[model samples]
Target: MTTSTSSKGSLQLFPFLDLKAQYRTIKPEIDAAIQRVMESQQYILGPEVESLEKEIAAYTQAQFAIGCASGSDALLLALMALEVGPGDEVVTTPFTFVASAGAIARLGARPVFVDIDPITYSLDPGKLETALTPTTKAIIPVHLFGMAVDMDSIMEIANTREIPVIEDAAQAIGAKYNGRAVGGIGLCGCFSFFPSKNLGAAGDGGLLTTNDPEFADNLRVLHNHGGHSKYECEVIGMNSRLDALQAAILRVKLRYLDAWTEGRQKNATRYSELFKSRGLDRILGLPRVQTGCTHIYNQYVIRAPQRDELKAALRGCGVPTEIYYPVPLHLQRGFSYLGYKPGDLREAEAVSREVLALPIFPEMSAGQQDLVVNAIATFYGTRAFAP
Candidate 1:
């Protein structure tokens, strides 16, 4: 199936993500699942939703899974369950999506920003110590770009300080750290099924996982207007329930997640090999997967000195590339009151400028991969002497 092209005249050879391709592969099953939900006419919490929660919990080895409206809501609900509110501070990285910090600010809690590790592009656990204070109530470690953060160190620090660790597994559903699942290792693991994630739904969906029964119960109430029974309000809450249709769709997609994850890993290996063969290491820093961690390659980002120019060159050659984030969360205009200035987090600031995400989906073809590699090589070869 050919993808519809935009007026930009570029081939549309690569999309940031190819959800359509995945849908085509599982059309029959997905259609059947949707039909089942439609026939049941149970639009809200039902058997499908309950089954999905149980399945996801079993898959992640967690005791419970609470589905929510979106990943941001999942984070917010987790914070609410932990009783994180005004005067509390949540320590987290300054490099992830705005929602990471936004979740904290929503509860009137200050988000203490920490620098990232240049190699991992994850919250630097080593730098976390200095950021802790008397008001620190929780630590949110985001598994940025499908790579797991050093959970052992983060958990150790959290345990020492008696602070809860919330794993922002939005980009890392199946990703593992030291043989443990990303979300299952923390106090509450938050996942996003925003179509672009490793295991995505047709639309916005999220789940919070935990082994603690009380935490799970709290999250359920937190997502459903703080009620146990209909119209019986328990605690102050917000509307964030995951619909049944999305739950059914997710169940079908979940079956294919592991195989898709393997494909992504294989594509990443191919990209690395191609770059190494052309001696591009001198000009680009390839992604590195730490020992014992399984990188799902949600975004095979590379650090290139002239990232923007390289991206433009790729566009000129029918290759698609994207900047994961051009600005760090701490430096964004919305958080100016945090008083973070330039050089506050040197690593995150530097990476924000240099990091570029190439076309990397599970269904990427080898020929497409070759085209992307050749485009980069040609760009570097031509521009090496321009300046």
Candidate 2:
């Protein structure tokens, strides 16, 4: 076994993500796609963007996929399509990125806070019912860190209340719940191509997937300034169309999305085995992939007692790590108008202090992984344990 000290000065530092490695591998195909877009000279909503939207829809098994400017815009557009505005309350988890809640608030809708599942780190389905009132119009269950939320339970709840579900699939592109693709299960699934997601573009991009034709048409108009045709404004809509350049790049990357997802799954398995063998299982809680759900492992996050100290030790040993969300959405200053207290969400508050994401990108090597795992083990070994 290679010790962390042996390669202390010689080891290359691992990054939390390795997009450049992926780019280098598919550079030829990517370059050709860009060249095609340039030669066509149709820079805006052209054939490239249209084709990518169709491809994404086909992949997710949705009737339509509307490309947009960013993931936040995708969520905002979904709410607009549903006509969510002031006096409406959208139930969602406080443990995810701020955009999950911010989108609703942008539409003048209130985002009612809900806690998360301790193991899956998704919106707690049980708490959702209590958060619901007559003002509740929808539930936005975010597939946090590439793991699908408990959609079966969420769907049942939504069906009972006659509310729609807008899936925040920004982190989970190929992830599935009960063999159904994430984006297709909900009323509308929102995806992001923010250069770091599982199916990322060269820059910022987003796509909205839906099975309802009318909802799909509404989204198209919402993304294109509330008009079906250019310069034909109907409703008060904003401009959030996807650029042809990013669409071209995304089309190239989509071909290899399945292969990349497989690699992430394999890496996650390796981390499980390595962590278990090192006897860190007792100290750290590994992520759990629910049965019948296929997790793409966008960020192989773990929960540990000394989460901050572990991150510092990993950095010292040339291993990279990240904290997905140090502050829960309800606790964030941006939503202070909601007037939430610290103990309001016990699970979200507890996990916010413990969750740490390890580098689990497709291009990550076993040697690099060993460095991260060994550093974690060393950190635990040196610290005092509680009885």
Q: Local distance difference test, per candidate?
A: 0.90, 0.90
Query: For model 2, where is the 10-residue window of minimal lDDT?
Result: 1-10
In candidate 2, which residue ranges exceed 4 Å CA deviation?
1-12, 382-387
Number of backbone-clashing residue pairs for each candidate, in the order shown: 0, 0
Inter-residue clash pairs, candidate 1: none
Candidate 2's displacement at residue 104, Å, is: 0.7
Candidate 2 lDDT score at position 152: 93
User: What is the C-alpha RMSD, rounded to one decimal, of candidate 2?
Assistant: 4.0
Judge candidate 2 at residue 220 and give its lDDT: 90
Tens-place lDDT per residue, model 2, 241-296, is: 99999999999999999999999999999999888877788889999889988899
Winner by TM-score: 1
Give one digit per residue, the lDDT tens place, for model 1 in 1-387. 254343566766666677788899999999999999999999898898899999989888889999999999999999998889999999999989888889999989999999999999999999999999999989999999998999999999999989999999999988888888889998989999999888898899999999888898899888998999889899998889889999999999999999999999999999999888888977899999998898998899999988999998887766778788899988999999889999999999999999999888999898888888888888888332111
- Model 1 ranges off by over 4 Å: 1-10, 382-387
TM-score (C-alpha) between model 1 and the true structure: 0.96
